[model samples]
Target: MEGNMNYFEIFKDVSVVFFIAIPPWLALRKYLKNYLNRAFLTIFFITYIIATLLTQNVFPFILVVLCFYFAIKMKDNFEVLYYLRPIKEKKTEIILYCLFFRFIIYIINVFYASLLEYVGIKVKAQDIYEIFLNAGWIKVIFLFAMTVVFAPIVEEFTFRHILYRGLSKKIGKQLSAALTSFLFALIHYNLAGFVSFFGIGIYNCYLYEKYGYRAAVVNHFIFNFISVLLILLIKIFNIPTVMT
Candidate 1:
């Protein structure tokens, strides 16, 4: 077990991980010129970790500014925003398909939750929940922005569009999806909801492959939105099972 540490301690550990990983990535930039940008990634990680620690009180504002900054910078290479543009065709079909996928994923999550409970694997909510649960309105708003807005955009780009796309080029899509899904679950740093997150990750990858990155983003938003709603409902209804 690890001892308790302050934010800077954790940031130090995170920096080390990036430091160790960055060199090989930098070396491969020549080969991966089109796919990867070492500078953007380096800056992104630095901003992400520091912004997370420093801007708790002004998270939404900082994130909004950063989002626009990235959008401008990524205009040409904006694979992240490409799918988010307005759709010309199959709009209705795509939405209906996404709604259906959400339902399917929900059912899978239920079963996956049950399985985790059966095996006695603890299912922990993501840490951000505790952070914003009883905080003031600003914090609540920040949580919403983080979960429903920024998380969907950043995570979908990183896990689905970027990582899965790159990996699928080497391995087949199936293997890539599996690997990316596991990484997605792993990054959330929760053991209990691992299966649930993995299921959603694969589902998002499927949406990205079949429909578009935008579809995956919408699906991701819906998932997180629903989770937020559930948390709200639990608090409102005082659900005993989850309360303890």
Candidate 2:
């Protein structure tokens, strides 16, 4: 019975990603190169309605829509898709910088967790981690794709590339980085993770400024890959540990 329930939960999660997430994402990517047209808008609204009906939590969809909206506005001036360019050089430097940022993020998480615990607030694993805790191997692999691959690309493009560059034009780099970092932390909807996310966001903004779009994406990818690897190890070894 428990096994059956786990399968059902996995099916539901996969359905949400397939039905609620992928179509709109693909549409946005397709239409992003060209000017905003009727076909793209139609598909977006259709997906929005379907997503809303499928899940009460429509915040993430709305957030993505907003990012794309801004992205379209900035398309004429900026190469909005420049983040997708291949990073052909500085492979070793990017990896080293990613490791440095990952260490800093870990420290931020530890400090935040300690502060919360001091105030009698327990820091628990994020929802994704909880899903991993109960998920079978198939579900774990699916989640690995979502977390380590899909999420880093979408998020780095949205937050570090589009949002950061747009804001930098109006505000100074420092202020823009701070605001973007706050928004990035806010979107996670996890209070326990806010500080860590904010720290990483700031680091990503620094990378975007110093190294350019692909470097920031690489850093984000490395960050998420480590977390997924840790989860895999825990599940394989049946190790007891707190994710947060």
Give the best candidate by lDDT: 2
Query: What's each prediction's TM-score?
Result: 0.69, 0.73
Among all windows of ten consecutive residues in candidate 2, which has the lowest summed lDDT?
A: 52-61
lDDT accuracy of residue 161 in candidate 2:
67
* lDDT score, candidate 1, position 45: 50
lDDT of 1 at 244: 11
Q: Tens-digit lDDT track for model 1 on 1-244?
A: 3455576468655643443223223323333455558798667556655654564323323443344355556573555456445555766777677667767766776677778879987666667666555667676877788678766766676677667887998999999999989978876666656766888888888878777777787878877887787776665675644511
On TM-score, the leading prediction is 2
The residue-level lDDT of candidate 1 at 89 comes to: 79
Tens digit of per-residue lDDT, candidate 2, span 9-65: 667566455434554455455555465677976776567656644542343445455
Worst ten-residue run, lDDT, model 1?
19-28
